[model samples]
Target: MKGLLFCVGLIMNCLFSTVSFAQTQNVSQQDALANTQKQLQINRYKYSTKAPKAIDGNSDFNSMDITSHGGDLAKLLGDNIYKVDSLVVRGTVDDVDFHTLWDASFNGKLSVINMENAEVKNGIIPEDAFWHSEQLNIEDGYITLIHLRRIILPNGIKRIEDAAFSYVVNLEDVNIPSELQYIGPSAFEQCENLKTDPLVFPEGFEKLDEAVFANCTNLTGKVVLPSTIKEIGEAAFWRAKISSINFPEGLEKIGDGAFYGCRLEEVHIPNSCKDLGIFAFKLNKELKEMHLPDGIERIPNNFADCCINLSHVNIPSSVKSIGKEAFQSCWCLNDVELPLGLESIDKDAFQSCYAFGQLVFPATLNFLGEECCTYLTGVKRIYSMASEPPACEVSTLNIGDTPFGGYDSPSTPNDIPVYVPVGAAEKYRKAWGWDYFTNFIETDDFPTAIHNININKPNAQNKVYDLNGSKVANPQKGQIYIINGKKRIFIN
Candidate 1:
């Protein structure tokens, strides 16, 4: 009986040990689950545009008992936004001990960090001595940057010193407090995909440092500039694929190619513009028309070249000069009305414009430069608003063979028609060489001759000449050649 009782006790002991082991395992799993819940439970709150609120100073953070109490979890949970309260000195400055505000993983990455009155504690590290941009930096190669999804910023965190958030690619979003004012350059340079959509700017921000978000190609969506900004630098948004932009009223100058090659269909030039630099819109073929403000004076050469769809344009009266070849190879251009205020026509200004069939001019026009209308051989009418008809070199052709493309007598005949000033036919006969036939039909007595010619569209036909001003071939296939290269012109 004693042996049997001892065996029973041993078996009971073994059962107790097994039961204890199972309970311990279950407890361990429960604790792990609780810890995970605290880490990931996100209260994703965003900053609102409320008025700035300042923090009060009363919490004694470095008390001996609480100093060793681990991360300041109670303080981190006190406010929705996290701002620097007061300096929480840990140990002696020389001890090289560092203290943390929030538990290193306390609120976890789930809560939006509102860093308002929160800052580096004293005794251990002061504000200015610590070049914060160099400190508190991150290094990551991936582009998601989703770590910053729930960060909160309280009002007291006034400034984001340089290099504050360098290369934290996992930072998905940013928390901005109203009290915060300034941001340094390259602060968020490579946060390529910080948000699911493009970032939206908060109001009250006046200045943006250079390259703040440079090379953020995946940051898609429209953004409006805050009116508080006055200047923008070059390559500010270079190679970015933004959709649309609306410039505020206070803008003065646009640094070189400030928004070059963006997919903007149209933009209004306010009166604030005084100058438009060269090639400002070189390859923006999508823009069909632009109306320059009256304040602008000069248009650079090839400023709007390669705009195949830019057909009709009316220069304002304020423009004084248009650069050479400004409208070269613009095949779609049809009608052009020169501004009466124009003073000069540069060489090749309107060359290769075969479509502009007419050029109406005021009597004030005095000069005709080289190749001004070289390829406009399709123009049939040259109407003038001046007191008298403008002179053409063709007057010499009819009066005598000397100016009929150098035909002295044989090629000259009654085939060409000449329009004269009322009774000036007799005078043109003597002074000009077109006095061959006895038919001198007066403009008023047109019915008498019954066969008068309108020099504008001379269906009667004129003698052809070679490049050397000698007759070569008859008119065929839109090309009329003359001997000695007598202006080989394209005829319609």
Candidate 2:
């Protein structure tokens, strides 16, 4: 009876212990599941404006989206997620991983991406952040950045800061929003392949700042300036291969070197452009014609230097001064009409211009600079409409510097004819430099005879004229002559 009772107690204790162990295991598993659920719930509630829940480890995706915070999308979208096609992250993205986005977007194969309201504290899009995207769109903010080939900007963007969209070689199409007001320096510089329609500034746009399109060698078509714009900053189109630009009627100023090294063929400055800075149209080799605006008071120094292909220009009556080296080395300039109000001509103003055939000086002119008309090999006649000779810079009996390829002697070539008014010949002959002009005729006798002066082609049968217009059989040293119908200014 005692043995039986002890066995029963041991069996009951064992059964009780087994039940307690099973109950403990079930409760522990329940706690673990509850904790995991709680953690997921906490994560879900973290974002204020959520798009969708993102799977942490999934490789293939059917347009799965998630809220990414503090640039963590770089790690979550692993290297194996090459199969994922589209990703649309919607949140306040203060930080981002460009490399990961580039790769996980399947080398920019993910067709559609919308990074809207990417809030940055300073309103600057960091350099090269969106470098490789073939197509992109930014909305709801202006974050200054560069390098997207094709982009559509948001309407709320008021400014594009300096160096934005620079060096993007493949950038072709840019949809500039209507509300954009300012474009800072070098905004689209070096975008070698960018081509756009006529860039007409919106009504309220005020300025196109410095170097806005410098070195954009492939940009074609015209640019239409807005009437409200007051300034075009320095080097705005330097080395830009643009063919045409339209200056609005009320445009105020064009800054220094604004259109230097361009292919602009012709320009018509409106009357409202009162200020023109130095070298404004320098090195425009294809610029064949231009007309200065009526309100311009001066042509600044080096204003049109090295414009080798320019042929015609019409100076308005309001211009009072021509600056130093203004038309220096213009080899193909053939014709220009000077206005009556001009008072001064600066040094080297028309140097090395071999094709200028005629010049008419107004009576109102008062000053001429050193070497003002040096090296013009083809200038055959000068018509001084002034009754009184303009006061020259030097007191010698020489006009300006000695003609190019001429000696420093006081004698001029004597081949160039100076025609004055009928009664003014004696006064010019008595003037200091005027006596050196060997050929002088009244205005009435000048035109017809001067135009008939023969330029003989040299052959065994032809005779060459020395610099003094004297016929010589053999080519002489230190003399320029007409050989084969071309003016040769030689000193041998």
Candidate 3:
């Protein structure tokens, strides 16, 4: 009986031990699950407050201690797994010191990152924190600063705030999200090394604030602007290496100095642009031709100023006035047809334009400001198409400097004749500015002829032609010419 009782006791003891072991295992798992739930609750509560939407898009969340517990909790939940909040990627995955899996994996790739549905709990990644990374993928996070080679922005991103990626030199490939509506001032300015094949903006894009891409020297090639854009802010592309751009139809205003000092060769100014700002296309020497929109009543000051290579410009009939220095220093401009309704030519309007050979004054012109044509040395004659000379005021020197370009030196007289209607000679000879010219001649009829003839054709026997290729049998004094294929010009 004692032996039997001892065996029963041993068996009972084993049963109790086994039962206790099972109970302990169950309790441990439950405790782990509770801990995981608690961790998740903590994480959610931590990041929910500083979210972009909750804060009205104020991206200043760098002080929060953001951490992820999703990965650890997934393991605890068994096959019904939850996504891991791969926290703070700082070092290689091989390093044991790094607490999170994301940090390990992110650091392992050195410069390439691929995070799926990740939220950056921290307000922003501080400027230049990842200078070594060549590419990045954090679509669902706010990024204020980084040093990356290529960027694939998230689809949920709406607005690129002020100077968000300014001066990110290595950034080459950029995927601007479709939802982006506004790009703040200086967003990508001074990024001298950034290069892209063609920068295409998304559909909802509305505004390009001041200096957005200013001083990006390496940003060459064409830009495809969308029709949804309404305004381009001041100095937007100042000093960029852009070669050409086509403004979309819906564009309303171009801010001042928007394209100053660029290498633009072709520009398509849409008629929708009613308010073209001053100095907008200044210092663009490569621009060869341009046509202003018809609705503009006055040419803005410094319009196309200093574009040395500009040869042809078609000003619409709607223009009533030419502003000061509007086409100053356009050295290669050979011809411009002014409208009959043009009322005024402001001071220095066509100063230093050396290639214009002649000018036809309009009938509606009432004011010709001083120094309007100060240095047009190539002009040989001036025609007052209007029977009456335009009204003008005397300069500070008391001498009317209206058509001042023809004067080379005081000793070398300005002999370029000013032609007027046969009966209007007396009226012009006494006019305030017109009387200043030394040679004023009366014409019976209008001389509306341009000299562009093929000299290759068998030289017309006994037919005299001027140096400008005009048939002039009665050669004028002090003008260079070809008398039947011979360089014999009279000095009077």
Candidate that scores best on lDDT: 2
Writing each residue's lDDT as its tens digit, candidate 1 over 1-492 gives 111112222433421122221122234323422332222111121212112223354322221112222244444434422232232322222112211332211222222333333432221121211112222212321112222333444444445544344334445566554545565544554444555343444466555554344445554556566665455433244333455555565555443233434344455555565545333343345555555556566555444544445555656666666654456555556556566555555434565655655455443343433334445534443333323332323322134222222233422233333444465556545543233322433353211111222222113354555322345445554433432223334353
Per-residue CA lDDT of model 3 for 1-492, tens digit only, reads 111112222433421122221122234323522432221111111111111211233423222112234334223322211121122321112111212322222222112233223332222222222221222212432222232455455455566655555545546656666667777666776566667757777787877877677777788877777888888876688777788777888888887668878888876678898887666788898988887887889887667889999987877778899876789899998757677788999777787888887777767777887677777878877778667788764444335344463233321125678888778888887876676577888886544322433233223565656645688756566444555455453443
- For model 2, how does the per-residue alpha-carbon lDDT over 1-492 read when each residue is reduced to its tens digit? 111112222433421122221122234323522432221111121111112223454534455465666467666656433544556554434325444554444242333334443333233433333332222212322212222345444445556666555555556766555666888666776566778767667778888876677767777777877678888877688777888988888888887678878888998878888878776788899888887888787887777888999877767778888877789888898745577888988667787887877677777776776666767777777777677876655523343443222234532244577888888888877765455566777785322111123434456766576533456676655335654333353343
Query: What is the model-wide C-alpha lDDT for candidate 1?
Result: 0.40
> Which residue runs of candidate 1 sit more than 4 Å off their true CA positions?
1-215, 275-282, 288-291, 300-314, 322-338, 342-492
Error of 1 at 342 (Å): 4.1
User: In order, what is each prediction's RMSD in angstroms?
Assistant: 26.7, 25.9, 24.1
lDDT of every model, 2 decimals? 0.40, 0.60, 0.58
Q: Pairs clashing in candidate 3?
A: 61-123, 71-84, 89-103, 93-104
- TM-score, one value per model: 0.40, 0.62, 0.62
